[model samples]
Target: MPHDHPMTVDAMLKQEFWEALYQRDDRIWSGNVNVNLQTEVEGLKPGRALDLGCGEGGDAIWLARHGWTVDGADISTTALARAEAAGREAGVTVDWLHRDILSWRPEDAYDLVSAQYMHLPPALRRDVFTAAAAAIRPGGSLLVVGHSPKAMRQFDGQKPPEELFFEPEEITGYLGDAWQWLVETCETRGEGHHTDAVYRARRLEA
Candidate 1:
């Protein structure tokens, strides 16, 4: 899925790009947690969780409120600040880590690891997703939600190269079938073709 993009991967990976993105406005993402995430995780018993690319702390905060101890991490300092404030406002405490998830590996395993809409080139995405899978303790789950390639037309073709978009199979194939495929659905967001590819798999217990 690596192809030519108007912006190089290096540019997108830099903290400056994300910092500028978050600094552009008081908020970047909707403060609410992602619908796919909540729908898939709402029934699970709360445990330690990790939210990668956890912009604005919405998912992490939501998880904490639901009784999971959460560590929310992102590359942008500005985003982290906003997330911290939001977590405080929501009356939930989240341990926020500022680091580039592309290269950072979690030191502790989690009962669940979620990455929502963290689109990157397919190669880089595989590495990050692999690490996410590794960070899950046995019998835990990994949830990945992405902008399905089916919805690429909704992006106005301005940002996030098409190469970054993917279908559910691309993710399920990478880490192998060691996981039980729990959820594989392309949810329609609303009218007009907007959709999200949601994938959730539970790690097979040893």
Candidate 2:
């Protein structure tokens, strides 16, 4: 069993925290897609995509390389800068934005809007999840990811214990009648560092 520790968002976003975490020689969380994200989104064609909480730009950069016009957003300037540098190095163009998603407003609709591993307090999670669902154009999709309930004990990083993790049913509850569920599942990855519930839903045409 892991040590019981207090968890908070403020504790998670300390300066140089995530950068130091990702900049390691091994690329522990470097911007790469593990099995979960790729398997779920493999059929998605390159198009307008919003990568929320896009740390180090791995997934966003990958989408761009595959032909998506991606806007990668993160609250960390350091992470965004590193992602920009990585994009340049990879010869891919990705728009990096340093903004908090809590206050972010969509200027235009997108074909795909993704929030991977965004663990917000209950209220904020609902707000953003709803907003993301609404931000999709007709026939567009919303992809949300968060650690699974079982992940609490296994994955050791920042997120609260599995008790605080939201399940796919909880997420679908938020969608209500606005969108149709395309996919939803809970899985483990990353040598036990990641246990996540993935949600993929498409807005129904009016």
Candidate 3:
């Protein structure tokens, strides 16, 4: 009966992996805005922001404090709970939605949509990133950061699946001609070994 569950096997695996990780620690990610996100967003005017795969609300809280109305979404209920608590602790309000990025459909466009280190199987990654792109309002910005394929060697003994890695182009290429690329590059961090592919683009007015 378990094997014949309603959810697809891939969905089950994705949930299991993230849930187990969240359970293993009080927090799986640092309670700080990702460096790339902070850097990329520093100059942009704040507005309605959507944070995809937002783990623990660090970035969302940061955006809220900087005058943006933030909506943070993640698949893991545990992570969403922590994110809500973090938002409270920061004295900022973030709309925390427990939803998988791969299947999410935004009801409204946002001035900024950010997905930091949102790695998934290639198919899922393309789908979610494309959707995120589409959710950006004209003249709005989209920022995506992911583990670059080059970082695979930095995993020590517990290497992630190769398919979870992506190049910046893979994400940027998903956008249509309406987007103007801003930042597209890879950068190393943390002992100069862990590299991330960072992409930032702005949608043109129709």
Candidate 4:
């Protein structure tokens, strides 16, 4: 099952490609919050949330339903439109922003900023993750999850690019002294040999 490639240059071309991908199907993802996300946030009190690369808005909707006001950001307009409709159907409201994560800058910090499975070029990913960590309010959390490098060997057919895969530390290392690590680990999923690197950290109170 091919997934949408990470954003590239040629802004218009990238948007059209992703839009077509989303329009080709009724849904692109499982339409449920990521297990890692669910596990990490299950105990935290709801607050202002930002779902980066929210695609189809699953995480955003989940956050909203759980009492957090959510802002879902994605590059594809079609995906955002579908997410908005899904939010309405789910009886929760999400502020959908049509923007690329690479260029997006939040006007305000969030209590929870999540970027799940957001695969981008190394430099761009580092920049975005750094900015995301910086956007967490004091005593808030930042969760970053992505495909582990081991997945390249585990799923030979997929052959994802090296730059797209990373270890939990690659993300967590971007955090400065302001953050406290809560969880940093990698685990394999059943059967497919799929692996995910998860990093959840809290911004220390200033």
Candidate 5:
């Protein structure tokens, strides 16, 4: 069955949207490193990593600090510049690319690919997942984290209403029948609008 709801906000392509969303507010996403990001990826050996929609480069810096070559991609040059500055300050090198995910392509495969809080419209979301899955090497992993549908009621923020946010089942459908489900859980975190749904899935080699 096809979901009829529009899944994406198209926030990446609009310069003004990014300017308003990112420009005067260059700071770490979530105001700190993603707790789940640290714990979930700690077990995997660091290698080439891609941070899709990397805002201010928090995760990218963290990954680079952990010994992975990080590519931080975002549509806002202002954001990318800020990320680069942070990377330099941290003494960690991260390749910052100002490219919209909808138009960007992987130059090569990666050991890890992550898209956090990038809630694309349904069709675009599927396209991105498929691309991200394909970009991972045989033994690599892919991670996506988004606002849970419940967040609409649990908190208040810019996140879309319940109708737009994702559910575990919806995410599973996006993964298709090909990827191996390593972890699928819906939980709340932070205060107010900070609560979100975190999901992690792995693509099998065989």
Candidate 6:
């Protein structure tokens, strides 16, 4: 977030915080797909996918172009609108939903459920991750990517409290034994100051 932006815990939980963020900038994220998402998913079988906190739909759009049927969900109307426009421009259709993933309930209906950079208070984040995991069907995958706490802590006042960032175990622990780890670790985001903690797991087929 920009130093001008307030990132209080209370502010982050409210939809207005994100709406205001989008309102402040025409485009906050790089329109290209996130690096971890691409590295982990590029060759995986494309299927039904739910993009939790889809942001501007870069990942969703890319997935659609690669053959996945995707649903993009986010809390900000501003972001969703941009995502829809981008989808249209890209000539791919994605079901976009206006939703706060923190409280959103989803079924075990997607072959993949992805949550990228959706940071929150750890307790709330566990709820968010559990809910997202529920959306993945048996034999499906769950992919989560977030800023690594270890490196992000160097940001001083610019970043959210260290508590808001996470370690790989902190994320993978949100899953029950029904899931098997595919990848669980952190890699430099290449910014030299930032690292990405990633967790990719597959729901065991019963």
Which segments of candidate 6 are over 4 A away from where they belong?
2-5, 153-157, 178-192
Candidate 5's C-alpha runs over 4 A off are 1-13, 26-31, 153-163, 176-194
Q: Compared with the true structure, what per-residue lDDT tens digits does model 1 show for residues 38-105?
A: 99999888999999999889999999999999999999889899999999999999999998898998
The lDDT, on a scale of 0 to 1, for candidate 4 is 0.80
Q: Give each model a TM-score.
A: 0.88, 0.80, 0.86, 0.86, 0.81, 0.90
Candidates 1 and 2, the one with greater TM-score? 1
User: Evaluated with TM-score, which candidate comes out highest?
Assistant: 6
Candidates sorted on lDDT, descending:
6, 1, 4, 3, 5, 2
Q: lDDT for each of the candidates? A: 0.81, 0.71, 0.79, 0.80, 0.71, 0.82
TM-score, ranked from best to worst: 6, 1, 3, 4, 5, 2
What TM-score does model 4 achieve against the real structure?
Answer: 0.86
Alpha-carbon shift of residue 184 in model 4 (angstroms): 6.5
Model 1 earns a TM-score of 0.88
Candidate 6, position 98, lDDT: 96
Error of 1 at 38 (Å): 0.7
Q: Write the per-residue lDDT of candidate 3 for residues 1-206, one digit (tens) a residue.
A: 12223333364447665676677778877889888899989898989999998878889999999999999998888889999998899999999998867787887899999999887887878788888888888778889887777777633244557788787777666775533544444344442347778888888776
Residue 104 shift from truth in candidate 5, angstroms: 2.1
Per-residue C-alpha lDDT of model 5 across residues 1-206, encoded as one tens digit per residue: 01222223543346556655665444535535677788668988888999998878888999999999999998878788888888898999999988878767687899898888776667777787778877888677777777765556431223353454665445656655553644434455554556666666766666
Whichever of 3 and 6 has more TM-score, that candidate is 6
lDDT of 3 at 200: 83
